[model samples]
Target: MDTGVEGRKASRVGVRVSAVSKTIKGNRVLDGVSASFPLARVSGIRGHNGSGKTMLLRAIAGLISIDEGSIEVFGEKLDARGDFPVGIGFMVEPLELWDEFTGLEMLTLLSSLRGRPRENHLRSALTRMGLDPDDLRRIKSFSLGMKQRLNLAQGLMDAPRLLLLDEPTNALDEDGQEAIRQVLIEERDRGTTIIVVSHDREELDRIADVQFIMGDGRIREV
Candidate 1:
Protein backbone atom coordinates (compact mmCIF):
# COMPACT_ATOMS: atom_id res chain seq x y z
CA MET A 1 0.00 0.00 0.00
CA ASP A 2 1.03 3.59 -0.52
CA THR A 3 2.62 5.34 2.45
CA GLY A 4 2.81 8.74 0.78
CA VAL A 5 0.81 11.65 2.18
CA GLU A 6 -1.66 11.71 -0.70
CA GLY A 7 -2.07 7.95 -0.52
CA ARG A 8 -2.83 8.15 3.18
CA LYS A 9 -5.30 10.95 2.63
CA ALA A 10 -7.09 8.84 0.06
CA SER A 11 -7.29 5.79 2.30
CA ARG A 12 -10.63 4.85 3.80
CA VAL A 13 -11.33 4.02 7.38
CA GLY A 14 -11.76 0.30 8.05
CA VAL A 15 -12.79 0.41 11.71
CA ARG A 16 -14.37 3.30 13.58
CA VAL A 17 -15.09 3.55 17.29
CA SER A 18 -17.25 6.34 18.60
CA ALA A 19 -17.12 7.26 22.29
CA VAL A 20 -17.02 3.64 23.40
CA SER A 21 -17.03 2.67 27.05
CA LYS A 22 -17.20 -0.62 28.90
CA THR A 23 -17.29 -1.58 32.55
CA ILE A 24 -16.68 -5.09 33.74
CA LYS A 25 -17.69 -6.19 37.22
CA GLY A 26 -17.78 -2.60 38.48
CA ASN A 27 -14.32 -1.89 37.04
CA ARG A 28 -14.21 0.46 34.10
CA VAL A 29 -12.00 -1.14 31.45
CA LEU A 30 -12.63 1.21 28.54
CA ASP A 31 -13.33 4.87 29.21
CA GLY A 32 -14.99 6.51 26.26
CA VAL A 33 -12.36 5.44 23.77
CA SER A 34 -12.62 6.47 20.14
CA ALA A 35 -10.33 5.84 17.18
CA SER A 36 -10.24 5.06 13.48
CA PHE A 37 -8.09 2.47 11.76
CA PRO A 38 -7.33 3.00 8.10
CA LEU A 39 -7.64 0.19 5.61
CA ALA A 40 -4.46 -1.45 4.30
CA ARG A 41 -2.40 -0.18 7.21
CA VAL A 42 -1.00 -1.61 10.40
CA SER A 43 -2.25 0.19 13.51
CA GLY A 44 -0.47 -0.54 16.75
CA ILE A 45 -1.76 -0.23 20.33
CA ARG A 46 0.55 -0.24 23.36
CA GLY A 47 -0.04 0.11 27.08
CA HIS A 48 0.86 -1.35 30.45
CA ASN A 49 -1.04 -4.24 31.92
CA GLY A 50 -4.67 -3.44 32.85
CA SER A 51 -4.62 -0.38 30.60
CA GLY A 52 -7.52 -1.74 28.53
CA LYS A 53 -5.64 -2.41 25.30
CA THR A 54 -6.87 -6.00 25.10
CA MET A 55 -10.36 -4.94 26.13
CA LEU A 56 -10.45 -2.42 23.30
CA LEU A 57 -9.53 -5.14 20.78
CA ARG A 58 -12.18 -7.40 22.27
CA ALA A 59 -14.80 -4.69 21.82
CA ILE A 60 -13.84 -4.23 18.17
CA ALA A 61 -13.98 -7.98 17.60
CA GLY A 62 -17.49 -8.04 19.14
CA LEU A 63 -16.27 -10.54 21.71
CA ILE A 64 -17.49 -8.15 24.40
CA SER A 65 -20.21 -5.55 24.24
CA ILE A 66 -19.50 -1.96 25.08
CA ASP A 67 -21.64 -0.55 27.82
CA GLU A 68 -22.03 2.68 25.84
CA GLY A 69 -21.11 4.27 22.52
CA SER A 70 -20.80 2.64 19.11
CA ILE A 71 -18.37 0.68 16.94
CA GLU A 72 -18.51 0.31 13.19
CA VAL A 73 -16.58 -2.10 10.95
CA PHE A 74 -16.60 -1.53 7.20
CA GLY A 75 -19.64 0.77 7.62
CA GLU A 76 -21.79 -1.75 9.52
CA LYS A 77 -22.55 -0.85 13.12
CA LEU A 78 -21.78 -3.54 15.64
CA ASP A 79 -24.77 -4.85 17.54
CA ALA A 80 -24.73 -5.49 21.26
CA ARG A 81 -26.23 -8.92 20.70
CA GLY A 82 -22.85 -10.62 20.16
CA ASP A 83 -22.72 -10.25 16.40
CA PHE A 84 -19.11 -10.38 15.19
CA PRO A 85 -18.00 -8.31 12.25
CA VAL A 86 -17.97 -10.15 8.96
CA GLY A 87 -14.63 -10.82 7.24
CA ILE A 88 -12.59 -10.41 10.40
CA GLY A 89 -9.70 -12.55 11.70
CA PHE A 90 -8.64 -12.05 15.30
CA MET A 91 -6.23 -13.69 17.75
CA VAL A 92 -6.62 -12.19 21.18
CA GLU A 93 -4.54 -13.14 24.23
CA PRO A 94 -5.07 -16.19 26.42
CA LEU A 95 -4.84 -18.65 23.57
CA GLU A 96 -7.18 -21.63 23.60
CA LEU A 97 -6.61 -24.82 21.60
CA TRP A 98 -7.88 -28.38 21.41
CA ASP A 99 -5.22 -30.26 23.36
CA GLU A 100 -6.06 -33.57 21.77
CA PHE A 101 -5.51 -32.38 18.19
CA THR A 102 -2.33 -31.89 16.19
CA GLY A 103 -1.52 -28.58 14.56
CA LEU A 104 -2.92 -29.56 11.18
CA GLU A 105 -5.85 -31.47 12.66
CA MET A 106 -6.83 -28.57 14.91
CA LEU A 107 -6.78 -26.06 12.05
CA THR A 108 -8.66 -28.48 9.80
CA LEU A 109 -11.39 -28.88 12.40
CA LEU A 110 -11.67 -25.12 12.92
CA SER A 111 -11.84 -24.47 9.20
CA SER A 112 -14.53 -27.10 8.85
CA LEU A 113 -16.65 -25.18 11.34
CA ARG A 114 -16.60 -22.14 9.05
CA GLY A 115 -16.35 -23.50 5.49
CA ARG A 116 -14.62 -26.25 3.59
CA PRO A 117 -11.08 -25.01 3.06
CA ARG A 118 -8.84 -27.33 1.07
CA GLU A 119 -6.60 -29.65 3.05
CA ASN A 120 -3.61 -28.38 1.12
CA HIS A 121 -4.52 -24.83 2.08
CA LEU A 122 -4.51 -25.82 5.72
CA ARG A 123 -1.11 -27.44 5.35
CA SER A 124 0.28 -24.36 3.63
CA ALA A 125 -0.93 -22.17 6.45
CA LEU A 126 0.86 -24.36 8.97
CA THR A 127 4.03 -24.31 6.90
CA ARG A 128 3.97 -20.53 6.67
CA MET A 129 3.80 -20.37 10.44
CA GLY A 130 6.97 -22.53 10.65
CA LEU A 131 5.03 -25.55 11.79
CA ASP A 132 5.33 -29.08 10.44
CA PRO A 133 1.92 -29.89 9.06
CA ASP A 134 2.69 -33.59 9.08
CA ASP A 135 3.62 -33.66 12.73
CA LEU A 136 1.37 -35.96 14.68
CA ARG A 137 2.09 -34.51 18.11
CA ARG A 138 -0.93 -33.32 20.04
CA ILE A 139 -1.27 -29.67 20.98
CA LYS A 140 -0.80 -30.56 24.64
CA SER A 141 2.78 -31.63 23.85
CA PHE A 142 3.68 -28.43 22.04
CA SER A 143 5.70 -25.68 23.63
CA LEU A 144 4.39 -22.20 24.32
CA GLY A 145 5.90 -20.71 21.16
CA MET A 146 4.54 -23.55 19.02
CA LYS A 147 1.09 -23.06 20.46
CA GLN A 148 1.28 -19.33 19.75
CA ARG A 149 2.22 -20.02 16.11
CA LEU A 150 -0.71 -22.40 15.76
CA ASN A 151 -3.08 -19.80 17.13
CA LEU A 152 -1.88 -17.21 14.62
CA ALA A 153 -2.02 -19.65 11.71
CA GLN A 154 -5.66 -20.42 12.42
CA GLY A 155 -6.59 -16.74 12.50
CA LEU A 156 -4.73 -15.94 9.28
CA MET A 157 -5.47 -18.97 7.16
CA ASP A 158 -8.75 -17.56 5.87
CA ALA A 159 -7.18 -14.30 4.55
CA PRO A 160 -9.79 -12.01 6.10
CA ARG A 161 -10.03 -8.36 5.23
CA LEU A 162 -9.57 -7.23 8.81
CA LEU A 163 -7.07 -8.69 11.28
CA LEU A 164 -6.85 -8.01 15.02
CA LEU A 165 -3.97 -9.42 17.02
CA ASP A 166 -3.07 -9.01 20.70
CA GLU A 167 0.57 -9.59 21.72
CA PRO A 168 1.22 -11.62 18.62
CA THR A 169 4.91 -11.97 19.39
CA ASN A 170 4.40 -13.44 22.81
CA ALA A 171 6.48 -16.55 23.54
CA LEU A 172 8.30 -16.23 20.21
CA ASP A 173 12.05 -16.19 19.77
CA GLU A 174 13.97 -13.64 17.70
CA ASP A 175 13.54 -15.49 14.41
CA GLY A 176 9.93 -16.26 15.09
CA GLN A 177 9.26 -12.64 16.02
CA GLU A 178 10.90 -11.46 12.82
CA ALA A 179 8.82 -13.89 10.82
CA ILE A 180 5.63 -12.50 12.32
CA ARG A 181 6.75 -8.95 11.61
CA GLN A 182 7.31 -9.82 7.98
CA VAL A 183 3.93 -11.55 7.83
CA LEU A 184 2.20 -8.48 9.26
CA ILE A 185 3.88 -6.21 6.76
CA GLU A 186 3.01 -8.54 3.93
CA GLU A 187 -0.62 -8.61 5.00
CA ARG A 188 -0.73 -4.85 5.23
CA ASP A 189 0.69 -4.50 1.77
CA ARG A 190 -1.99 -6.86 0.52
CA GLY A 191 -4.64 -4.29 1.58
CA THR A 192 -5.62 -5.99 4.78
CA THR A 193 -6.55 -3.72 7.70
CA ILE A 194 -4.52 -4.83 10.72
CA ILE A 195 -4.78 -3.72 14.35
CA VAL A 196 -2.09 -5.16 16.58
CA VAL A 197 -1.46 -4.78 20.31
CA SER A 198 2.12 -5.13 21.53
CA HIS A 199 4.19 -4.06 24.49
CA ASP A 200 7.37 -3.60 22.45
CA ARG A 201 7.48 0.05 21.50
CA GLU A 202 10.44 -0.35 19.17
CA GLU A 203 8.80 -3.17 17.30
CA LEU A 204 5.61 -1.18 16.91
CA ASP A 205 7.56 1.79 15.67
CA ARG A 206 9.10 -0.41 13.04
CA ILE A 207 5.87 -2.04 11.82
CA ALA A 208 2.96 0.22 12.69
CA ASP A 209 1.80 2.90 10.31
CA VAL A 210 0.05 4.59 13.23
CA GLN A 211 0.38 4.11 16.98
CA PHE A 212 -1.85 4.58 20.02
CA ILE A 213 -1.03 4.47 23.71
CA MET A 214 -3.58 3.43 26.31
CA GLY A 215 -3.59 4.38 29.94
CA ASP A 216 -6.15 4.19 32.70
CA GLY A 217 -8.78 2.95 30.27
CA ARG A 218 -8.18 5.89 27.96
CA ILE A 219 -6.32 6.11 24.65
CA ARG A 220 -4.17 8.74 22.96
CA GLU A 221 -2.48 8.65 19.59
CA VAL A 222 1.28 8.67 19.88
Candidate 2:
Protein backbone atom coordinates (compact mmCIF):
# COMPACT_ATOMS: atom_id res chain seq x y z
CA MET A 1 0.00 0.00 0.00
CA ASP A 2 1.13 3.56 -0.62
CA THR A 3 2.69 4.97 2.53
CA GLY A 4 0.03 7.46 3.76
CA VAL A 5 0.38 11.12 2.71
CA GLU A 6 3.74 12.03 1.20
CA GLY A 7 4.74 14.48 3.95
CA ARG A 8 2.58 13.68 6.96
CA LYS A 9 3.96 14.31 10.42
CA ALA A 10 2.73 14.84 13.97
CA SER A 11 3.06 18.57 13.45
CA ARG A 12 -0.49 19.20 14.56
CA VAL A 13 -1.90 17.15 17.40
CA GLY A 14 -5.45 15.96 16.96
CA VAL A 15 -5.82 14.13 20.23
CA ARG A 16 -3.57 14.70 23.22
CA VAL A 17 -3.50 12.68 26.42
CA SER A 18 -1.61 14.46 29.14
CA ALA A 19 -0.43 12.19 31.94
CA VAL A 20 -3.80 10.48 32.00
CA SER A 21 -4.57 7.62 34.37
CA LYS A 22 -7.61 5.52 35.15
CA THR A 23 -8.32 2.96 37.83
CA ILE A 24 -11.01 0.32 37.78
CA LYS A 25 -11.90 -2.18 40.50
CA GLY A 26 -8.59 -1.60 42.21
CA ASN A 27 -6.59 -2.18 39.03
CA ARG A 28 -4.77 0.61 37.26
CA VAL A 29 -5.99 0.44 33.67
CA LEU A 30 -4.15 3.58 32.58
CA ASP A 31 -0.90 4.73 34.09
CA GLY A 32 0.13 8.25 33.30
CA VAL A 33 -0.43 7.74 29.60
CA SER A 34 0.65 10.65 27.46
CA ALA A 35 0.50 10.58 23.69
CA SER A 36 -0.33 12.74 20.70
CA PHE A 37 -2.36 11.49 17.75
CA PRO A 38 -1.68 13.71 14.77
CA LEU A 39 -4.19 15.18 12.39
CA ALA A 40 -4.50 13.73 8.87
CA ARG A 41 -2.67 10.57 9.80
CA VAL A 42 -3.38 7.09 11.08
CA SER A 43 -2.13 6.41 14.61
CA GLY A 44 -2.07 2.76 15.63
CA ILE A 45 -2.10 1.17 19.06
CA ARG A 46 -1.41 -2.50 19.74
CA GLY A 47 -1.28 -4.55 22.90
CA HIS A 48 -2.32 -7.81 24.47
CA ASN A 49 -5.76 -8.24 26.01
CA GLY A 50 -6.45 -6.12 29.10
CA SER A 51 -3.40 -3.96 28.38
CA GLY A 52 -5.46 -0.71 28.45
CA LYS A 53 -5.64 -0.14 24.71
CA THR A 54 -9.44 0.09 24.61
CA MET A 55 -9.53 2.15 27.77
CA LEU A 56 -7.28 4.72 26.18
CA LEU A 57 -9.53 4.90 23.15
CA ARG A 58 -12.49 5.36 25.45
CA ALA A 59 -10.81 8.29 27.11
CA ILE A 60 -10.09 9.90 23.78
CA ALA A 61 -13.65 9.41 22.65
CA GLY A 62 -14.94 10.85 25.95
CA LEU A 63 -16.80 7.62 26.65
CA ILE A 64 -14.97 7.35 29.95
CA SER A 65 -13.43 9.88 32.29
CA ILE A 66 -9.84 9.75 33.42
CA ASP A 67 -9.18 9.87 37.12
CA GLU A 68 -6.04 11.93 36.69
CA GLY A 69 -4.73 14.18 33.95
CA SER A 70 -6.57 15.45 30.89
CA ILE A 71 -7.46 14.93 27.25
CA GLU A 72 -7.83 17.42 24.43
CA VAL A 73 -9.32 16.96 20.96
CA PHE A 74 -8.61 19.35 18.13
CA GLY A 75 -7.27 21.96 20.57
CA GLU A 76 -10.32 21.90 22.85
CA LYS A 77 -10.02 20.35 26.29
CA LEU A 78 -12.51 17.57 26.84
CA ASP A 79 -14.84 17.90 29.80
CA ALA A 80 -16.06 14.61 31.14
CA ARG A 81 -19.13 16.33 32.60
CA GLY A 82 -19.95 17.83 29.21
CA ASP A 83 -20.66 16.51 25.73
CA PHE A 84 -18.41 14.21 23.72
CA PRO A 85 -16.07 15.56 21.09
CA VAL A 86 -18.04 16.74 18.08
CA GLY A 87 -17.21 15.46 14.60
CA ILE A 88 -15.94 12.12 15.91
CA GLY A 89 -16.87 8.68 14.60
CA PHE A 90 -16.01 5.81 16.95
CA MET A 91 -16.40 2.04 16.58
CA VAL A 92 -15.24 0.07 19.57
CA GLU A 93 -14.82 -3.71 19.80
CA PRO A 94 -17.34 -6.38 20.81
CA LEU A 95 -19.56 -5.12 18.02
CA GLU A 96 -23.08 -4.35 19.13
CA LEU A 97 -26.00 -4.34 16.73
CA TRP A 98 -29.77 -4.65 16.70
CA ASP A 99 -30.05 -8.33 15.78
CA GLU A 100 -33.60 -8.00 14.49
CA PHE A 101 -32.89 -5.05 12.19
CA THR A 102 -31.68 -5.20 8.62
CA GLY A 103 -28.50 -3.35 7.73
CA LEU A 104 -30.41 -0.51 6.10
CA GLU A 105 -32.88 -0.32 8.94
CA MET A 106 -30.11 -0.17 11.50
CA LEU A 107 -28.32 2.57 9.64
CA THR A 108 -31.50 4.52 9.29
CA LEU A 109 -32.24 4.28 12.99
CA LEU A 110 -28.72 5.36 13.93
CA SER A 111 -28.72 8.17 11.43
CA SER A 112 -31.98 9.47 12.85
CA LEU A 113 -30.32 9.78 16.24
CA ARG A 114 -27.42 11.63 14.61
CA GLY A 115 -29.37 14.20 12.54
CA ARG A 116 -30.73 11.73 9.98
CA PRO A 117 -28.12 11.31 7.30
CA ARG A 118 -29.57 11.07 3.79
CA GLU A 119 -30.82 7.72 2.56
CA ASN A 120 -28.35 7.76 -0.27
CA HIS A 121 -25.51 8.38 2.15
CA LEU A 122 -26.45 5.38 4.25
CA ARG A 123 -26.82 3.20 1.18
CA SER A 124 -23.50 4.35 -0.15
CA ALA A 125 -21.81 3.51 3.14
CA LEU A 126 -23.19 -0.03 3.07
CA THR A 127 -22.22 -0.48 -0.56
CA ARG A 128 -18.71 0.72 0.16
CA MET A 129 -18.39 -1.99 2.76
CA GLY A 130 -19.62 -4.61 0.31
CA LEU A 131 -23.06 -4.92 1.82
CA ASP A 132 -26.27 -4.76 -0.17
CA PRO A 133 -28.30 -1.94 1.26
CA ASP A 134 -31.54 -3.40 -0.03
CA ASP A 135 -30.94 -6.82 1.47
CA LEU A 136 -33.73 -7.92 3.76
CA ARG A 137 -31.73 -10.23 5.97
CA ARG A 138 -31.48 -9.26 9.58
CA ILE A 139 -28.15 -8.49 11.21
CA LYS A 140 -28.43 -11.64 13.32
CA SER A 141 -28.09 -13.71 10.16
CA PHE A 142 -24.93 -11.93 9.02
CA SER A 143 -21.55 -13.62 9.22
CA LEU A 144 -18.93 -12.30 11.59
CA GLY A 145 -17.11 -10.66 8.71
CA MET A 146 -20.28 -8.95 7.57
CA LYS A 147 -20.95 -7.69 11.04
CA GLN A 148 -17.45 -6.25 11.22
CA ARG A 149 -17.90 -4.51 7.91
CA LEU A 150 -21.23 -3.09 9.04
CA ASN A 151 -19.60 -1.76 12.16
CA LEU A 152 -16.99 -0.01 10.05
CA ALA A 153 -19.62 1.36 7.72
CA GLN A 154 -21.49 2.84 10.66
CA GLY A 155 -18.43 4.73 11.84
CA LEU A 156 -17.44 5.90 8.38
CA MET A 157 -20.82 6.81 6.93
CA ASP A 158 -20.88 10.38 8.14
CA ALA A 159 -17.33 11.17 7.07
CA PRO A 160 -16.42 12.58 10.48
CA ARG A 161 -13.32 14.63 10.97
CA LEU A 162 -11.96 12.22 13.57
CA LEU A 163 -12.24 8.44 13.39
CA LEU A 164 -11.57 6.03 16.23
CA LEU A 165 -11.65 2.32 15.48
CA ASP A 166 -10.88 -0.71 17.58
CA GLU A 167 -9.70 -3.90 15.87
CA PRO A 168 -11.35 -2.80 12.64
CA THR A 169 -10.28 -5.92 10.75
CA ASN A 170 -11.62 -8.33 13.35
CA ALA A 171 -13.26 -11.39 11.75
CA LEU A 172 -12.50 -10.12 8.22
CA ASP A 173 -10.77 -12.23 5.58
CA GLU A 174 -7.71 -11.20 3.57
CA ASP A 175 -9.70 -9.32 0.97
CA GLY A 176 -11.77 -7.60 3.63
CA GLN A 177 -8.64 -6.61 5.48
CA GLU A 178 -7.19 -5.11 2.33
CA ALA A 179 -10.36 -3.10 1.79
CA ILE A 180 -10.12 -1.72 5.33
CA ARG A 181 -6.48 -0.74 4.79
CA GLN A 182 -7.39 1.17 1.67
CA VAL A 183 -10.30 2.87 3.40
CA LEU A 184 -8.03 4.02 6.21
CA ILE A 185 -5.49 5.37 3.76
CA GLU A 186 -8.22 7.28 1.99
CA GLU A 187 -9.46 8.72 5.28
CA ARG A 188 -5.96 9.85 6.15
CA ASP A 189 -5.62 11.53 2.79
CA ARG A 190 -8.89 13.33 3.40
CA GLY A 191 -7.36 14.91 6.53
CA THR A 192 -9.35 12.84 8.99
CA THR A 193 -7.52 12.13 12.24
CA ILE A 194 -7.66 8.39 12.84
CA ILE A 195 -6.61 6.34 15.83
CA VAL A 196 -6.99 2.61 15.39
CA VAL A 197 -6.40 -0.20 17.88
CA SER A 198 -5.35 -3.58 16.58
CA HIS A 199 -3.58 -6.67 17.79
CA ASP A 200 -1.98 -7.32 14.42
CA ARG A 201 1.41 -5.64 14.34
CA GLU A 202 1.97 -6.18 10.64
CA GLU A 203 -1.41 -4.72 9.75
CA LEU A 204 -0.79 -1.67 11.90
CA ASP A 205 2.63 -1.14 10.34
CA ARG A 206 1.02 -1.19 6.93
CA ILE A 207 -1.54 1.58 7.66
CA ALA A 208 -0.20 3.59 10.56
CA ASP A 209 2.06 6.56 9.98
CA VAL A 210 2.99 6.21 13.66
CA GLN A 211 2.55 3.21 15.98
CA PHE A 212 2.49 2.76 19.72
CA ILE A 213 2.67 -0.28 21.97
CA MET A 214 0.48 -0.39 25.07
CA GLY A 215 1.51 -2.69 27.92
CA ASP A 216 0.49 -2.83 31.56
CA GLY A 217 -1.36 0.45 31.19
CA ARG A 218 1.60 2.35 29.76
CA ILE A 219 2.44 3.28 26.15
CA ARG A 220 5.61 3.77 24.16
CA GLU A 221 6.19 4.55 20.49
CA VAL A 222 7.76 1.93 18.24
Clashes of each: 0, 0
How much RMSD separates candidate 2 from the native structure?
1.7
Sequence-dependent TM-score of model 2: 0.94
lDDT of 1 by residue, 101-203 (tens): 9999999888887776768878877888899999999999999999999989887878889999999999999988988988887888898999999888988
The TM-score of candidate 1 is 0.94
Give lDDT per model, in order. 0.88, 0.88
Off by over 4 Å in 1: 1-10
User: Which pairs clash in model 2?
Assistant: none
Which candidate leads in TM-score? 2
For residues 50-142, write the lDDT of model 2, one tens digit per residue: 999999998888888888998989989998653577788889877579999999999888888888577887898888888999999999999
Worst 10 residues of 1 by lDDT: 1-10
- lDDT (C-alpha) at residue 157 in model 2: 79
